[model samples]
Target: MSRVFDAMMEGLRGNLLRMGGRAEAILDKALRALWERDARLAQEVADDDVEIDRLEVAIDEGVLKALALQAPVAEDLREVLAVKMIATDLERVGDLARNIAKSAARSAANPPIPFPAALTSLARSSQRVLRRSLDAFSRTDAELARAVLAEDDAIDRAQDEVVESMLRALERQPTAASQEVDMIMVAKHLERVGDHATNIAEDVILVAEARNIKHAAKLARNR
Candidate 1:
């Protein structure tokens, strides 16, 4: 029975990794479409979202089956629950990437505006956060997952700067409001990607350390 349970866990982990890899790739493609102003690539990103959705459903079903058959306890239970949470985060990341792709397509239709430096930094930072979070999960590295959490604040700041700069641009060139607004939406989507990555990192910490850090800050403040 233990052997069967172990095999089941391994299979679930493999599926989660495959899903994460696909989500990461789709995110990269979406960003490339935005940067390169490729409507075709943007459309591809939207079309690829269905794959992530399918994986999420599969992971959910696997989790239910594992719970019913294995009745995982303690760390095993934590691992199972964390995998489900991580899959949900990855699914949201895919959705946000599709939103960015839509913004990219819209921006491509209009005359190109100078991409804000802050927006560029936000995009890069968010992508790095997401990649690092996924890596931490793959290795079950609590330290790396904590580091990913630390980086989330900087991504948030970068996003704010991007928004402020875009607003200023809006003020200066009212005629370009549509492009600026699209850029603002793109920045927002990227920030949300960072948020989802942070959630994944938190789940990694849960599985690695048996700690639930979600809402820890708020809980501490209330205390």
Candidate 2:
């Protein structure tokens, strides 16, 4: 029974990793579509999201099976629960990537506006946070997870800069307001990707240390 439980855990881990990898790739393609104005790549992102949705369902079912049959306890229990939470975050990331792709397709239909360098930097930063969070989970490295938590703020700041700049551009050239709005929405979607990455990092810490720090700061402030 113990050996079977271990095998179940391993299967869950492998599926989670595959889902994470696919989410990351879809995000990259979505960003490229936005930057290069490639509508075809944007369309591909929408199609790729179906696989992510499927993996999330599989992981959810596996978690239920593990709890019902294996009855994981202590660290094992935490690992099983965290896998479900992280899978949800990865699924949301895929959804956000698809949203960005939609924005990309819309932007492609308009006259090309000057894409902001800050937006590019924000995309890269968000992607790094996601990759590092997945690595932390893969390695069960609490320290790396904490580092990902620390880096999320920078992505937020970069996103703010991009949004503010886009707003200014909108004011300056009201004729291109539609295109500028798309850029603003893309910045928002990228920030949300970072937010999901942060959630995954927090789940990593939960699994690694059995600590629940999801809203630690807010909770402390209320006290």
lDDT by residue (tens digit), candidate 2, 1-223: 4999999999999999999999999999999998899999999999999999999999999999999999989999999999999999999999999999999999888899999999999999999999999999999999999999998888889989998999899889999998898888889999999999899999889888889999999999999
Clashes of each: 0, 0
After best superposition, candidate 2 residue 27: deviation in angstroms?
Answer: 0.3
**In candidate 2, where is summed lDDT lowest over 10 consecutive residues?**
151-160
Overall lDDT per candidate, in order of appearance: 0.91, 0.94
RMSD of 1: 0.9
Pairs of residues clashing in candidate 2: none
Give the per-residue lDDT of model 1 (tens digit) for 1-223.
Answer: 4998898889889889988988888989999999999999999998899999998899999999999998999999999999999999899999999999998899889999999999888988988988999999999999999999999889889988989999999999999999999999989999999999999999999999989999999999999
Error of 2 at 208 (Å): 1.1
TM-score of 2: 0.98
- Residue 207, model 1: lDDT of 90
| Per-model TM values vs. the true structure | 0.98, 0.98
Q: Model 2: how far is 68 from its true place, Å?
A: 0.5
